[model samples]
Target: MADEGRRDRCLAAHEAPPVPPEGPVTTRLPRRSFARSATEVAPELLGHILARRLPDGVVLRARIVETEAYDQNDPASHAYRGRTPRVRVMFGPPGHLYVYFTYGMHHCMNVVTGPVGTASAVLLRAAQPLEGMERMSIRRRTDRVRDLCRGPARLAQAFDVDRSLDGADLVRGSEIWIERGPGASAASIRRGPRVGIRVGTDLPWRFWIDGPWVSVSRPAAVLSPR
Candidate 1:
């Protein structure tokens, strides 16, 4: 795809504003109204690129890895628990932000996956470490390629994504955006259960490029359920 080369080659190869010396005014579509819907959001994100601006001012990018769909009917989702200040954004339109704090102090990000009111979203489980490799190494404090951006929480930190990015838009924003990345050869695309959710694990919602070191975990090729 048009973005794969941009990502695979170099972060600067893509035409995005460099992080300003004093931080430019954040301008873009307000992703405050998009609801989270997993079913619709997962498959749609397959070829999209997920990018974040790092601390050093370089943009760190990754291709979407495994994703899980969450919706109202999906008992495992947080929305089903009802609206609170934290999830209020999930109740907004179809292009809003849904940010939350979990695992003690780490922050994780999710794209409101489906249309408004659907409350479905795709959980960005893992990403193939792309641009900003050195900076990523610094933030993650590791030189091991597989350890960086291998999990939802780690990727968020590596990309410098936090509550600050909540409600940021992807269609036209510098903070986070997806570009068309490499096509997983039909045979290379692997699918399975979404990670870490005891309830949703039964559903075949996870997806990843077979054997790409960037997959958050080295899950064996799953042909069917566990």
Candidate 2:
């Protein structure tokens, strides 16, 4: 209960802006954009909009604010041990959603990066609610708009993401896609160690925009201006 209270306080620290009348008019990122390494794609995803089209025709959108990179060679990556049934999608083509269940309760979403046959992905850590706030609020069980999509699990829950979305194509699929937005400036981007990983703890692969919407607390050693 103490942890829950702290989470609530952290979420309440930022006031959500008024919902925009309309979402930004932007184009979906091309498949080629995700063909590079996860480290390269992670930082670049900040400020982009992730759109989820529900079965009821309601579209939920969020601006990605935090991401962490993972490669098969990285000790912290699921695919580090080699190919397996669970990580087959990671070795597939780029620009696909790699949704996985964690802690037996939460589902985290990743964007497959790198070329075919390589296991590299970017974990979308947090996003700022954009379109469909009412739906997101209802799904998240919170009226505080800032709390709707503050963490990866929360973001997935708000968007109704689950194992069913695993391997969903983001570049060409209609259900889930990422659209270009006013990207975060390089100066505002910060890099630190990834969260909740026992291995690869020292690698500064986590990237996020310096903003209240970021999921985790600010790291003491922020390597930025890249």
**Tens digits of per-residue lDDT for model 1 on 1-226?**
1255533433342235533322332332234323334654565565556666543457777776666667766777788887767776666566544666787788877777556666666667677777788888887899987878777788777777666566655655555665555634445556666767778567776766654554455454533322
Please, what are the lDDT tens digits per residue for candidate 2 over residues 143-197?
9988889889999999988776778778766567899989887877889889899
Candidate 2's C-alpha runs over 4 A off are 1-26, 220-226
lDDT of 2: 0.84
- Per-residue error for 179 in candidate 2, Å, reads 0.3
- TM-scores of the models, in the given order? 0.74, 0.86
lDDT winner: 2
- The worst-scoring run of ten residues by lDDT in candidate 1 lies at 20-29
Residue 143 of model 2: what lDDT? 97
Clashing pairs counted in every model: 19, 0
